[model samples]
Target: MASPLLRKPSLVHEGDATIVHQLLAQDTGLEYVGFKMIDLKVKARYEETLTDQECCIVALTGRITVSEGEHHFTGIGTRESVFEKKPTDSVFVSGGKQFLLEAVTNATVALCYAPSLQQLPTRWIKAGDVGVERRGKYQNQRMVHNILPDSDPSASSLLVVEVYTEGGHFSSYPPHKHDQDRLPEESFLEETYYHEVEPHTGFVFQRVYTDNRSLDETMSVEHRDVVLVPAGYHPVGVPDGYTSYYLNVMAGPKRIWKFHNDPDHEWILARQ
Candidate 1:
């Protein structure tokens, strides 16, 4: 079964306002993998700049205009429908430089980055590009976003995927793990889950831990709750009432994210 690993939201102060950041993994004592999920409310006509970091933003609600110097990035406006995997208009700020932003309307955004400004090959995969598939006994249909390809043998350093789960369905059930880098089926890779629950209501459950030493944590993960996987098996499960959508951010020395499951439930793999 998948165990539980969760960290409380950390408060990050920027300008005169405040933003809540859910830190999933860090490169220091916390973990060499750097990851974070941030919720930002862009005030109308309120523009902010970023520097000394490489970042990506996903609009949660409302609309905003992102600018880099004279360059402009107009996001999909509200009431016009938001599309995933659309152009992520990106900006690079090396050595502590700031980038600029302005909100055409009140908006919330998610931003992610590495501390040293190390740029990972980033791409914007529209939700349209992901082929929806069913996994686990629940037969929950979900759209999986693959951030990295398996063709490059050297490219197995970090594997990232986002799953948009429909309401009233379950994913990551019959919990499994890849903590043992032993056989062809078992390869350990740290993982992270940044969830965006629809309607901003209800909760989801996520588990993580070693095979015999399972630990469970149930969090009311809403629009921006982040779950971390440091050194064990992790699986994310959503309840029946809410449509849970999450972005999985993973990074490790080995690029592959292979795993073994508790024999008790491993049989479910055959159905997939």
Candidate 2:
């Protein structure tokens, strides 16, 4: 049986726009996070008014312009593909704002959302502003790009990031979980993973499981697939000859992120 947490891409036509995947928190039994990936052709525009959620618009590929009220941000993206290993541009839109996205070239954009009542400024995040880090070691190595981390304070509840794992490598490893809301210890965050594989035909494996073994499922994820992490420790492993890339969106009652690694696997961190 197919796991409910594994979401495959389905095209939905919205007037001139084609949404590759649209997921709401309610759809996944989550509380705060929601996601959408839109495909736009050259000169095509998509308009929306965010009534109760703040959004982070991430340009996955090609170039696009975002306009809100009198503010216009033009030519905001650069990379032609997610595998390019370069930081991409993103824009943060506050709640109750009306925004427009127009493609200067054929583009794919990701929208990461979280519920909010605060009306903050709509800010443009340039590609240069993104913080890139190389995380883990040996087989657990991966590249991380922090787009809208909790420390930024620009967002009320959403935390967005991009990760790249090489072939035969592991990511989100040591099997960490943030399902508890024990302040200063662990937080309760619901997350979504939008995955894309290099070469388009390859696949990766992701396991979402709890310590009690009650909610355990391993998924073979392909390009454009999404994995929902409602609760539990989630980790990703890429098979040999296939590189992996994923956009992560997370949200919870609080904006901070504190995680606990599985005690059984935490010993791996001691290895040089």
Give me the candidate number with maximum TM-score: 2
Give the lowest summed-lDDT range of ten residues in model 1.
85-94
RMSD to native, candidate 2: 0.9
* Local lDDT at 10 for model 2: 92
Q: Encode model 2's per-residue lDDT on 1-272: one tens digit a residue.
A: 89999999999887667999999866677789999999999898999899899999999999999999988999889799999999999999999999999999999999999987587888998889899999999999999999999889888888999999999999999999999999899999999999999989999999999999999999999999999999999999999998999999999999989999999899999997
Task: Compare the candidates by lDDT and give the number of the best one.
Answer: 2
Over the full model, what C-alpha lDDT does candidate 2 score relative to the true structure?
Answer: 0.93
For every model shown, what is its TM-score relative to the native structure? 0.67, 0.98
Find the 10 residues in a row with the least total lDDT in model 2. Answer: 24-33
lDDT by residue (tens digit), candidate 1, 180-226: 66746766666667776656766777666565665545555556667
Q: What C-alpha lDDT do the candidate models reach, one value each?
A: 0.51, 0.93
